[model samples]
Structures are given as structure tokens and as C-alpha cells.
Target: MTVARKRAILTADSVPMLPAHVRLIFNEKRDSWVVLAPEKILWPDDISVLILQNCDGARSIGEIARALSKEFSAPFSEILGDILEFLQDWSDRLLIRLAEQSGGKP
Candidate 1:
């Protein structure tokens, strides 16, 4: 059976949280930074700082997920729903994109 894939749509109005508000605590021993937001965002553990960094309203979810899969050795096929779920949580928290302003239904 073939699974359906959702193509991520990019918009101009999607604004990521600013760097100042998002703080990173690097664990040199671990070689990864622990990103802390003033409040919780969705699935923070599943996403990395780089993934959030590139979500600058230009890259689509598919693009980011693909890159993340390559960089982090994650399965791209399984990450789509997870990405969408993250986007939904971020939307609820007003973190990632202004969904209504973006003009497309997810």
C-alpha cells in the first residue's frame, strides 16, 4: 500500500519566534543545544534548533522535514504528520505561522 504525502505550502506571513526570545543552552559534552522558549512549543524534542531556525516563512514543511531527515537520520515518510502536528500546536500558541493570514487550510 502506498501512503499519501502532503505537500507543504509556504507562505510569506509565517514568522518564527525571534532569536532573543528563544534561548539555547549548549551541552558541549552532548554536542547539541537545548533550546528553551519562554513557554512550551509543540514536540520540542522532535525538532532541533536548526529546523526551527530555517522555518523562516520561506521553507515548506516538506523541505524542512526532508532536510531534517537527512541531517538527523530521521525517517522523512513518518515525519510529515509529526510536522503538521507541530505546526498545529505552534499555530494554537501563536508561535510559528499566522494560519488564518497564510490563506491556506492545512
Candidate 2:
């Protein structure tokens, strides 16, 4: 019998990081950023590059959104919503994972 692992649930407080099998790199030949997984490559646009670069496993979703909002002069709410959706999509694709909680709280 096989147990299906549950997918991670993303939230405002979730700290996103690239999984061990995933990497984000600048493809010089393509002159763009690409996400490399075991069997897949994703070419992200400029805005997505900004978001992916900030997923350092240390900042929460809210923190990232706040920084992006300030950098682009966009509204916080809009940025947050976009970030949440973006992260969730990547998380579902197994490219990103939520960092383990530091404290004893789950």
C-alpha cells in the first residue's frame, strides 16, 4: 500500500523555498531566468523573477509582498494576492515548499 503525501498549504505566514530537486537560474543563452526541476524547465517573466529571487526560506509571504509593493510602488493588497496565487501554484507543482516552523508550534 502506498500513502499519498499531502501537499503543503500556503498562507500569508508561509515561508517559501525551493525544494532540493528544484533550482532557479539565469540562463545566459536564453537571457532569462528559468526554473529547473527534475524533468521540467519553466521560463518565468520579469515580475516572476523578482518573486522567485526573494523566496529565500527566511521571509514570510507577507514580508515578500510588502517588499515587492514598495519596490514597484504597487498596492499591498494587490501584491499580496498575486504573491499568494503565484506561490500556491508553484507549491502545487512541487517546485516550492514551506519552510519548517522554527519554534515548537506547528
Candidate 3:
């Protein structure tokens, strides 16, 4: 997926996912995981991997942050900024596609 010239403003209701051509793979050769975007390959840190896994085009951004907060043992308010930053960065890189959410989904 290509990053749009006009980016979408992410919100609590936004659901993000990797484009079809983009994927996360365990690169045995590199001894690490990598995000293989159509334009480039990226090596992400552990926290990044967790963020990527959460972007399944289902969970909203708020839900994603809450889950991450639990996993990292941090308060949601404390981690929210960092989570937003990561999502925005990846979205700008076309590693994630954000969808508009109407309401909470089961």
C-alpha cells in the first residue's frame, strides 16, 4: 500500500491493518523479524512487532492502546502518545492502512 498524500487523522475508532502486499516475517537469515513492505524492508523492535500484531483491521486504536498498555504494564494515559506516534509513523510509511470504525465490534 502507498501512503496517501493526505493522511487520515487517526482516532479511537480507527482500525488499522497492513496492506495485502505488506507482511511481517521472521527472517531467519537476519535472525530477526522484518516488515516487508512493497517499497522497502524494515526491521522493527519488539514493541513494534506487538503493535503490528494488533493492527488486524478489527480493533480500534483505543482498544489497541489499552491492550498494549496491559502488556507493557503501563497506564493507558502514559502509553497512548507513543502508540499514536508509532501508528502514525507506520501509516505514513504505508505499512498500515486505517479503516473508519462505526462502533465497537465483537
Task: For model 1, give the 10-residue run with minimal summed lDDT.
Answer: 10-19
Off by over 4 Å in 1: 1-48, 98-106
lDDT (tens digit, per residue) of candidate 3 on 1-106: 9974877677667788877779988999979999887779899998888888888888878999998898879999767778788888887777778754323332
Candidate ranking (TM-score, best to worst): 2, 3, 1
Top lDDT hit: 2
**How many clashing pairs per prediction, in order?**
0, 0, 0
Please report the TM-score between candidate 1 and the true structure: 0.50
Candidate 2 or 3, higher TM-score?
2
Cα shift from native, residue 22, model 3 (Å): 1.0
**Model 3 residue 40 distance off true place after TM-score fit, in angstroms:** 0.2
Model 1 C-alpha lDDT per residue in residues 1-106, reported as the tens digit of each score: 9996443343322433323454445667866666566775333453545656666545666776777778768788766566656665554554555323455332
* 1 or 2, greater by TM-score: 2
All candidates: TM-score: 0.50, 0.91, 0.83
lDDT of each: 0.55, 0.87, 0.80
**Root-mean-square deviation per candidate:** 10.2, 2.9, 4.2
Candidate 2 lDDT, 30-50, residue by residue in tens: 789999999898999999889
